[model samples]
Target: MEWGMHGWGMGLIWVLVVLFLVLGVLAFAKYLIKG
Candidate 1:
């Protein structure tokens, strides 16, 4: 049970990190296009 919870927490963290990175890249691309 403990290991399952730990793995789930790590997965959630990675998902958030990936999502943030994708958003950052999209924003950067938009800025580059506008500039």
Candidate 2:
């Protein structure tokens, strides 16, 4: 049970990281277009 929970936690962290990266890229693209 503990191992399963740990694996789930890691998966959540990875998802958040990917989401942040995608948002960062979109923001950078918008900035480039505006500038």
Which segments of model 2 are wrong by more than 4 Å?
Answer: none
Pairs that collide in candidate 2 are none
Candidate 1 matches the true fold with a TM-score of 0.89
Candidate 2 per-residue lDDT, tens place, 1-35, comes to 47698899999999999999999999999999999
Scored by Cα lDDT, where does model 2 land? 0.96
What's the alpha carbon RMSD for model 1? 2.0
Q: lDDT value for candidate 1?
A: 0.96
Off by over 4 Å in 1: none
lDDT accuracy of residue 8 in candidate 2:
91
- Write one digit per residue (lDDT tens) for candidate 1, span 1-35: 47798899999999999999999999999999999
Each candidate's number of clashing pairs is: 0, 0
Evaluate residue 7 in candidate 2 and report its C-alpha lDDT on the 0 to 100 scale. 95
